[model samples]
Target chain A: MSNEQRPVWHKRVTEAISADELAEREALWVPLTEEVRELVSTAILSEVDEHAVALARQHIRAAQEILGTKVDTGSFGMHVNDEGLAWNWGNAATGQKNAVAPPLCQVPIADGVRYEADFGAGYEGPPGCLHGGWIALILDHASGRAAHLEGNGPTFTGTLTIRYLQPTRLGPAVAHAWVETRTANKFVVRCTLSTEDGVTAESEGVFVLARWARKPQED
Target chain B: MSNEQRPVWHKRVTEAISADELAEREALWVPLTEEVRELVSTAILSEVDEHAVALARQHIRAAQEILGTKVDTGSFGMHVNDEGLAWNWGNAATGQKNAVAPPLCQVPIADGVRYEADFGAGYEGPPGCLHGGWIALILDHASGRAAHLEGNGPTFTGTLTIRYLQPTRLGPAVAHAWVETRTANKFVVRCTLSTEDGVTAESEGVFVLARWARKPQED
Candidate 1:
């Protein structure tokens, strides 16, 4: 559907979900998820409109070429509309091609968002420490969700600061994210990750200039 | 053996070994890989003193705690030292307790260090991108090796900064590390990670306050 012709559920879904809840909803929103997957796949196949798929493919190929190998264990999926188009490419914790990630998929909800996943070995950093970068990934996703919730089109990680309070052990961990403030296209997002007992990590970030790269494709 | 009574080789091994081939008389001067492992393990276990057996038991318990649980999978085997002390708590990429980690093991080279390992599907981020955290873990290990080489005693990562110049893919990758500078108890280390052809990641960091933490016994 065209941007103006898109359904309201897209907006509702984007606004009503938490990062954790959205992750849980990945299976439930299979139709929407599949729709995005198909659209992006088709766009890439046709080489027609300049879309997120084109941009992602370009980047992915650049990375692969530089690294000198084709990575088959991962993929990028996307969906589009006037409210915004979202693309999650080769997400490590949840990509089909990723052998070292936790299983993760996210959707939209309310003014904030939530995400949850179970991680196992293949991400070790310390003797028993979870590689710190995985922690940053979760934070970045949460920050991105916070931006998405505030309608900040799309943005890149301008700066990210993470504190390793304790060695994050790999296991089932849950994360929650949401917008704390917004100004023009700039947004402040607050997030937290926890397991069954207490919090494992906390994060907050500022996302700016939604659609900074290209005006949220006029659809 | 107590610190004062330990074999002279124990103290000599930590020093830099010459790269040139050793004659039979210089054999003791050459650092053997197995010997180095034993020495470090011995030094690490030295702190346990009378608690060596208890420490081994803890290692077993910690390993058992994660095994067959939802988290134990592609991790490395952690064993105690000849001093009969063990530390299987966990590691970022490949500790026995870190379920989300990969298999990482250190090998002592002529005068520095090298690491070997394989990664799989679960650690993806971005599309086909290795989760940023996985990169950090590899970098951390590389940096840590640099610290170990400078003979700066075991050090904690005071701070680590990583720039994701490009997304990393899964599969076989190699990392090499060495010391850049040393100041008293502080040592500066730098390292890099590469695929088959060229460098993919580079890291630099400071390792300081040698042996700040007393052995478990002293604590």
Candidate 2:
């Protein structure tokens, strides 16, 4: 299918689902996925017997067969609305239970948003420090979410710049993002990532509203 | 422990392990971790009963208890040498079978390096498109690896800038990184991420040699 003709979820769809319902569903899925995520970490680090691995694979395959193929189609499945509800449970950065997600919790603040998460051994990069890429992932998600909240529409990251100030330790980390400026459909968002010790990284991102959402005058 | 007093892995240690041995170990670890990774993705997407979930958790806990904790240390575990043999199989970005790792295989070429990997559903951000943050993860890794290969030692990412030209589809992808310029301990590197269709995103990164690696003259 052509780019324009492809099945895409528009920004307006955010209104179709009630925030309370989405939040409730997310609550249910998050813990289930979190269990699976912990399972992954354990499987990777643990030295399980071949018999256990075999049995686990059998169970996994059975589950897969039962679930079949169901795909999520939308703003890359990471859309966050004004209510601070995002239906991106399958996303790697913020999806609850997604093995790859840091599973950040979005907290609405006065002017912007804050993400709370903890990185464990699964996210290690340097000794006790959080992996730099994972750091980028968190900032990228927070920035995009910030843009979506401020822009009131679907947006995609155009450019992201991150500077590693110091080693961010694994465990509880906080990331905050706010819209620095907006002109037409473009948003300039800035973010800071920190741990108990202090700021570990900072980032700036330019997010452009999806093509379909852009006003003719802006184009 | 104080940051300065912590037992950080010195860049000089890359010389401690032979390149051939590291390569061999990575070759072995990659497939094993790949299995664990597939298990994770499968578990997340699978449909299982509460009993299955409970059973899976039990099995996972048993494994964790049996294995105990063994943390990897040194170079923050992302070290790659001049020859491009990085002992970073435990890293989140490129570690084999690491659910977090895209598990890129670095191929040394004349004047640059190429990374090859497949991003599956676990890394998805927009429907079939690879997660943008994961995109950043791959670029950040390739750029840092490029700097390490060219600069003759370990380097950390100082700044990374990425532009998403289009939605990068999930599946086999190729990323290439080359050094653009250098000044003292700072090296500028450029990277491009693409699938069979063509270039999806491009990045430029500034990498600075770690503090302990810098010489008095370079400082």
Candidate 3:
């Protein structure tokens, strides 16, 4: 089926920035994001008393004040360059600038999409287990990425159905997604989340390439 | 309808701490969590040069070092007191200590359950819209909370089906969840997500109270 329906919200930004500048900016933000993520994990497990906690808060507030001096107005939507490179650095699944996003790293696969992350203290739900919500995010992202690669543009998840086989442990986990079938604008994809205990959750999703995003079909 | 099925993982921790200490600890971490979340939003919008960025990193690192000095091992699961009060500040939905969680504030309502949050850049997707995965998280958590209240114990989402009516816009949004039907242990809950754009997403889920958590029936 085709996704002839109009999207409620979508945007593409083409910025006039060089490749070198982008790389340099990424180098700066990536470390800060990682450190912020680590700080979260550390805060959860830290047994510090009142004095240390108070001092940490002071340091955090100072950092915030410095960064807040110059701010943008709204969300970081998709930004692309003339070189055919697109990046959404605020993406919740694997944004370079987002600290709350799981540490999902894309892996090269011959026919599909793969992502790996070591689920840590901040990602836990039930004791020693990955949160159910994060699982949904991972499955949706991996499947969407697979569809985006095949469709050669952006894709949104129309519907997703997930089955929880067991609780996923809070450690290294992998997600692998591949398209099962496709039409002119819609693609059906399947994804699985696995850990040391084997497959913990699996999902089937319908993703759509909006009409405006479709490439011209070669005749 | 009852869940006799054993869970993959669940635990209850009764700590040797008092109410005063708990309150003091909460006072310390809540602000830090808020600041960190705000810092993430600021970093996304900041157009700062390298000097400002470099300086901000030092402050963030200092905070991390101070917090990381005294750390515990593994995840922070459910912790309770002898007074029957429970707190899981590490929860992914609205954990007071978790910076990644949406700022969900529970509102007292006569029916079902209600939660409100102003989703910001950290929760953004599709331009100025909330991510689909987070929609899933909000719906799941709201429904689970409803079930937990009625069942008077922990509940799990067995299956959830979400229909995305439109893209939920960023900023203030509300989640309303209510139990549709129930038996001795199983509940079918329905939830709706709305922003200024009306109802954007809705869900129906099956929540089960694990057998081990159920209380004895009256004679």
Best by TM-score: 3
In angstroms and one decimal each, the interface RMSD of every candidate reads 21.8, 5.2, 5.2
Query: Which scores greater on DockQ, model 1 or model 3?
Result: 3
Each prediction's Cα lDDT score? 0.45, 0.71, 0.81
What's each prediction's TM-score?
A: 0.48, 0.79, 0.91
Error of 1 at A120 (Å): 6.1
Which one is best on lDDT?
Answer: 3
Q: Ranking under DockQ, best-scoring first?
A: 3, 2, 1
**Model 1 TM-score, all chains together:** 0.48
* lDDT tens readout by residue for model 3, B111-161: 999999978778876776788888888888898899999888778778777
Q: Candidate 1 on A2-76: residue-level lDDT in tens?
A: 323211111211244455654443433332222222222122112122233234334323322322222221123
Question: For residues B68-160, what per-residue lDDT tens digits would candidate 1 score against the true structure?
Answer: 132222332243444433343234444432323454667778655688665433343433344555665677666776675566355555545
Quote the positional error of residue B21 for candidate 1 in Å. 31
Model 2: reference contacts kept, as a fraction: 0.34
- Tens-digit lDDT track of model 2 for A2-59: 3442324222224445777666655655565676566556544543445555555555
- Cα displacement (Å) at residue A183, model 1: 10
